[model samples]
Target: MKKLTSWALIRQNLSRKPVRTGILAVIVFLFSFTLYCGTVIGQGLSQGTRTTAERLGADALFVPYGYDAKVQSSLLRGEPSSFYMDRRFSEEVRQEKGVEKVTAQLFIATLKASCCTLPVQLIGIDPETDFVVRPWMASAIDRPMRDDEVVVGSKIVGQVGDTLTLFGKELTIAARLEPTGMGFDTSVFLEIDRARRLLLASELGPRLNLPAGLDRNAFVSSTLIKAAPATDIKELVNRISQKYAAAYNLDFVVVAGMITDMAAKLSFFSRCIHVFSGVLWVLGALVMALVFSALIRERKKEFAVLRIIGASRSALGRIVMREALLVSLSGAFAGVAAAMLVTTLFNAYIGAVLDAPSLEPGPLYRLAAAAGALLLGLMTGPLACLPAMRKLGRIDAYIIMREEL
Candidate 1:
């Protein structure tokens, strides 16, 4: 006896019900698309949070009490802001016990086409005392920045010696720093002397009620501090707070943390995406199961006819399973392709509108997501056919055959 060929039967059965097969495939495609997108977003957010925090490279940020939120928004979103504290405040923090290093920074906001464009956080640092920005600049350009020259962020559009108008002053770009998916990516670091001169000539100088002499060393926007090893970070913050409490008004808020809040928020958001993905998966599974169940029910007569022709029940079952697989495979391919197109569009254009610190998940993560979607889509085929397989085997074959006759 010639045994039935499941492969040939699988093709014939699917081609016979093109509409049904197509609908089933569309369902699987939807499942794959959502899973792929969700995986990428969740993974990207997680990586961005960590990279943004590490790029800060500080144990704590000390700023004016109410400016804490603005500083965060400034660093993360590049929102324009100009806040200042008396210079003596910086000197006092340095004397605090267990404070290993302290650096003062001045943030000057300017027009996008001008210096300090939110993309270029116009900042001034004393090269001799700067422990933070120098390391990053050194790696990108072999030579140290000279006066009247500035180091730009990786994303800033320009080449060395290209001039930028910062605070009405055109300064030469000395070097560009490597991008870290943080505020630094757009930051423009200048020597303290130049940054101070530029700030004084800008509108900020008049707005801050400058002294008659207009001393640059008199005010700074904020301070970045690092604690000595083994020193309790929280304790150091407290000590700094106590020292300032009696002498100066409590206008400064000391942030003894890195990207804690941002990271936590992103983590929660990623979990929500995962939950949404799970719900989508459940819906996809139910759709696949119901459609296949109804499809098998309609094919009862077809199975009965095969039985009369000497086709075994198991062979008939294989045909249905194979058809399910082809349908699912088709959907998965379509879904993954759609997901790739959507992601590419976002990275190329839509992402800039967000104007927030972000990191692209590496290739390894993206590949894993695609592979997972493929495997999951393949599994649904057999799982959806379970009930149909049993019914095809146990159904009253004689009744189906009699009805067909």
Candidate 2:
């Protein structure tokens, strides 16, 4: 008789219990899939919150009070809108005790600005006195932005020097900003004067609700502010309210507040998801332990025969370990495949539900995450067999064989 090789014996053992092994593998697959998804979601939450805060770059924002909802919507959706405020109040806002710098912007809605022919939000910033918009483009844009020139968002499907036509005015795409995971990714930034020229030249002027003979330079949509050092932002808000009383309707969007809200809400939601995954993991481990224990009991007669053939106690344990390892490894790979597919297919929808502006982590980060998850899954199998291993030394194979006889 040919001596059975270790691999052959292990293969035969697994074939004999196909049903049990498959069930165990399926459980691992489900547990691993849920855990991996939770990890990716958490990564997205962190990335979205940080990107939003850094992109806004304003300590505080002041917009038309009654139209606060509209302002927020425009910023979030990157849709063009028309609203006007007295540009003169900018000085008053800057002169406030806790205010450091103040700048105002004009937001114009355009048709056919987006590559897909959707409306695009065009933001105009004063190059001479601007701090917010220009700084974001510092790394990408080297020179002054000329008339008929624009800086496109990272999401815009074009490169530097690409020409895009908006409202019949040709715009040279001078620079492109990195993704902010928000409306900024979809907006076009250009010189304030150039924006004013385009608005005044366009046929949509009358429909934009501009005052008769309005001075473009004298109107602004909202004021962006940077508060002074050690200033209590809440107090600064109060001052802006009192000082600009009746002159402007004020709706303040503090950067700190926005970040706090985003972080808090997402953190809470992620925790709940993780807890759900955790429960599944524990339940899977429990089922795995029970299954392995029963497997050892049912195979007692087989173990006794192997012992009679001179197979040691340690050899039997090794066989059981191999079965568990094979089940775990197969399930882990399957789970990872499922998770990758789910994240890729429904990430956009998931991002929306989680209020994560974007779920685009860099390629390197994604690769590392996948590798880590695979390694973690590999370890779970050995861990699941610990309870069964403890009973291996005391399992009396000979006594069980005699009772069966």
Candidate 3:
């Protein structure tokens, strides 16, 4: 003897045809899920490119000829690679007229490093001369890095003070840096002397055999240069390339050019996702309209009976709308939750696949995205039911009952 209110009736109605209700809910779920994932992914990539550019903090980079791609992959995708250039190359670059600061780093791509399960890049830096990485490290460690002490990137497994074995050498972790959304996150940083020691160690060093006449103590992987104030970056790049390209067989990588290229690719990727989402939105709306129209027809007798039993035209309309609202709300919550879970679990893999390591968005951005997706989801149901509600308003109870017979 419970009162049969509109909401109560709607609950009963949906419970009776569970399959149909599930179908409608699934349609909305797909739309919302796709929208939320696409939005987050696009924003993450754009932000990642900006973060990477800031992290580089240099005008241009110099690497051995034919190894530019290797350096790019190592920086952007966290791919472990080993290449070396003469240490004197950095000294020469430091003396250039337009060069404000110059620093060199040595690279060793290690397999089965104790810091991570996957292969990670090992970097060697001179704390005194390093302008690129030293600033970031300063916040993590107050004192100078010792020969046996190493600094780790954010993604490295162990905490500060933990010992990690590198090339059979046990090194202490002195500090851990904040995430940079670049290959550096999986890299380990050490002093130049320690790096050279590992490279010269007889037992495990010969596997990456050094080229003849290339002294381990005098080899570096890349020369990072910061241009002087108001310096013409293009002219500087051209001058350096001309001087070193043939003489030293070096490649010049302009940081700005790298970012611009990444941005263009990200723009195209974002557009594709936006267009696909738009198409899905339109298709979802159309399908909802058709489904609801048929549902209203099938329930004509049910509405007519309610009207005879003291239900107003408006009340009957409310019944249909309330059902749609319930389904939409449920679908929206479920879809967004699924998207969040998937993204969280596979964030690193997604970045690797996209080749753009992006910083995770703040909570406010996530809240806004969820709100937008839910709003769209909520709107779809009510708008689709509008025509059905109108149809219900014009139903003649007596005529409908007669047709049912």
Instruction: Give each model's whole-structure lDDT.
Output: 0.72, 0.76, 0.85
Candidates ranked, most accurate by TM-score first:
3, 2, 1
lDDT score at residue 357, model 2, on the 0-100 scale: 61
In candidate 3, position 305 carries an lDDT of 91
- Report the C-alpha lDDT of model 2 over 1-405, residue by residue, as the tens digit: 978887688778877888987898888888778777777767766786787777667787787667565665566545467677767777677767878888888887776664546678888898877778788789888888888789988767777888888777778889999876676777898887678778877887655675444456577777888887898988888777777745665667777887797788888878987888778778887888898888777776787788778888788778878878878888888997898788767754676666556556766776776777677666666777778877776667678778986
| TM-score winner, 1 or 3 | 3
Q: Ten residues in a row with the worst lDDT in model 3? A: 202-211
| Regions more than 4 Å wrong, model 2 | 1-20, 73-83, 117-119, 210-217, 341-349
Candidate 3 matches the true fold with a TM-score of: 0.95
Q: What lDDT is reached at residue 360 by model 2?
A: 63
lDDT of 1 by residue, 1-405 (tens): 856577777878788988878888887887888788777765665565576666666677777656777777667655566766655676778888898888888877665655433445777776776777776667877876777788887768788889987766788988877766566666778876677777777776666564333245567777788788998988887777777844543343334343666566666766776787678677877877888788778878878888888889888887888888888898888888888778656742322344345655677877888889877877777778888788888867788787766
Clashing pairs in 2: 80-109
Model 3 residue runs over 4 Å out of place are 1-3, 211-213
For candidate 3, the per-residue lDDT at 113 reads: 79
lDDT of 3 by residue, 335-373 (tens): 888877777677677878887776666678878988888
Candidate 1, residue 67: Cα displacement in angstroms equals: 0.6
